[model samples]
Target: MILTVISAWRSLLAVAGLSLTVEGLYYLIRYLKRFRERRPPQVLFFPAPVTCVRPLLLSSPGHCNCSRSHRESALSCLTRLLLSARRSLDVCVFTISSVELSSSVLAVHGRGVRVRVITDSDYMALAGSQVGAFRRAGIEVRHDQDANYMHHKFAVIDGLILITGSLNWSAQGIFGNKENVIIIKSTDVVKEFIEEFERLWNEYDPSNYSFSPKS
Candidate 1:
């Protein structure tokens, strides 16, 4: 009778261990199935011949070569934007004084790129020489400093990339203090910026726009 009771107890313990093992496996399988269903489907087929949906190239402010002075990383991003520009370049700014940045504009013009600049009236006198260089390069530069205190900073490149921010084209803004900016690579965003630049460019008459040199 003693031996029979011991045998029964061992059988019960074995059954309990097996039951727990099965329960644990059931929960694990359920969890794995749920996780698999939530995962996104893999696309094995290409939508546009595998080449059209090509990788979207991206570059941030720190990737490009910029002057060492500016803390906002605007110049670095601006350099990348300028390098990526093709066909056309549109810039709308409130002030302009940075030689390196202006030289980037001039360089693009020299490459047969169409460059258009919209500036503020306050600095048109100071920007005369730079503007002349743009004109000499067959680039168009206009100012609307009189229109509601124009204080915008946007640059549209090739009708595709848009760079808009609080950082002006000035040396101080680019290389000095903290500033905010957005570099948008979406076509829709670029179109919106282009439209805004053109609207402001047309509102003011360049014929009546004039600036007198400092006395």
Candidate 2:
């Protein structure tokens, strides 16, 4: 009788242990699932030392049979870079008249990415300029109000890639005139450009604009 009681107690204890183990595992799995759901998805960018240059010299008009070759054009390269922004896009340029580039900016903005544009105040009012369109689209745009030109032709994409050079985001700059664009993925270089962009963005804020009294 005593032996039977001991065996029964052991069996109960063993069953309780198994139940606790199963419960622990169930809660562990729940915790892991919730943690994964809370974490943001990781995005991998191209490794550093990745650089691209544009305004690839085009073959003589008749000699170039394939229009697809123009995909390497500076405009196309810039547009592709702009479209690659998953988090943010900072554009600081003297002027923006290229419809393709503007469209890319708008597209990224529509994707819920933060888009900020800084351009020359004077040029923003000029005809055929896309700065106005950017504003109408509800994207934040800032421009230098002083007499000096806000002559910057650089864009920091996702704070990872830096696109800069003599190439203006304009039809003439990309297609007609000789121009150059450099796309770099260096962390150090991109950090500097990001700082500059933030500084200009703050300096050009409407709240910081000053008006001189008329004499």
Candidate 3:
């Protein structure tokens, strides 16, 4: 009888041990499934009004009474932005002829800032267009592949600062025309302009390109 009791107790203990092992395995499987099924994090953006705002630098030629030197012109502001860029510069102007501005852009390009220039198919042949100077400097330049007129006058610097206005990058626009060049310091605004710039840049198609502004 005692032997029988001992055998029964051994069987009970074995069954209890097996049950504990099975329970542990079941809980481990449940934990793994929950870990694998959890959703990934979502990306969010703040609205414009609540989004970050930076300094607003303006260059209204009509508002200034400064000397008629490159140092005092609206182009100086653009040159400064080119000099300040550490990463990238996207320039979409109708025409850029000022040698000072071109030299500044070339300096940054030499320093390894990715610089892209887009101009109008018709305007690049203007007597004062600096398209040749840009090409000579080994800068990547493109124009509207279509005759629809890529008359965009804006630039995004370092993915943060945005420069846009009626100001063209020419001696006339700087010295002759009344222009308003706004230097906006908003990441969100810059992103929007950059996105649009990229779209135009890709569509213009520089693969089989040439600079033949129609006479």
Candidate 4:
């Protein structure tokens, strides 16, 4: 019995030795490979205000099953940019209906930020449209019903930050459809979106209508 126990202990030690040797060889090979194929750094430093906010790319329904998490994430990213407004906000999107996003718009507007919105005219009467809410709050909101398609999803914050993405401001656009939004801090880009918004706002503005500034 004692001999058998001793033999078992010897076998255990042999296995442990073998494992240590294998581990040592693996680390040594990894170190050599890294040393032989060392690469340069990939990130570049920029002096300008070029930066990236959280990017939420949701998978499309056909590509992958859409979940509530994806929708909420996309909405949150939009809301984050909305809440950061201080001076003025110019929004040009196809449609918008998320209560969370609408609430954020109202919040920033309430704090004395100038808010202008241009959307698709057909969506004004859509079931989930928040056009009424913005109009009621005295926000300058218009719709390009006359145009064949006013398909733009972007927001310019204080004429300094620009948020442009594929995601619409609706339940499906946020949570269901696959989308990408890019927020950039460039005056030239912001100017381009602002110009587009002005062109649409002018075309949709009716002489008989009036939107009084609440503040």
Best by lDDT: 2
User: Which wins on TM-score, candidate 2 or candidate 3?
Assistant: 2
Q: Candidate 1 on 1-215: residue-level lDDT in tens?
A: 99999999999999999999899999999989866544432111111111110011222223324333333333544664676677988988777676656777877777788888987766666733366666777777777745465788788888866777777666566546467667666565677888888888787657655556546
lDDT of 3 at 17: 97
In the range 37-118, model 4's lDDT, one tens digit per residue, is 4432112111212122223221122332434232334455566678889999888888889666777788778878999988
> Which residue pairs does candidate 3 place in steric collision?
none
Worst 10 residues of 3 by lDDT: 45-54
Ranking by TM-score: 2, 3, 4, 1
Off by over 4 Å in 1: 1-74, 127-129, 145-147, 205-215
TM-score of 3: 0.62
TM-score for each of the candidates: 0.59, 0.66, 0.62, 0.61
Q: What C-alpha lDDT values do all the predictions have?
A: 0.66, 0.77, 0.70, 0.71
- RMSD to the true structure for each prediction, in A, is 15.5, 10.5, 13.6, 17.8
Residue pairs with backbone overlap in model 4: 71-175
Per candidate, the number of residue pairs that clash is: 2, 0, 0, 1
Model 2: weakest 10-residue lDDT segment is 43-52
Q: What is the lDDT of candidate 1?
A: 0.66
lDDT against true structure, model 2:
0.77
User: In angstroms, how far off is 98's CA in candidate 1?
Assistant: 1.2
Give one digit per residue, the lDDT tens place, for model 3 in 58-145: 2222333444332333344456666777899888988788665666777778788999998898889888777887788788888886
The residue-by-residue lDDT of candidate 2 on 107-189, one tens digit each, is 88988999999999888888889987888999999999888998889988899888887777776776566666777776767
* Candidate 4 worst ten-residue window by lDDT: 41-50
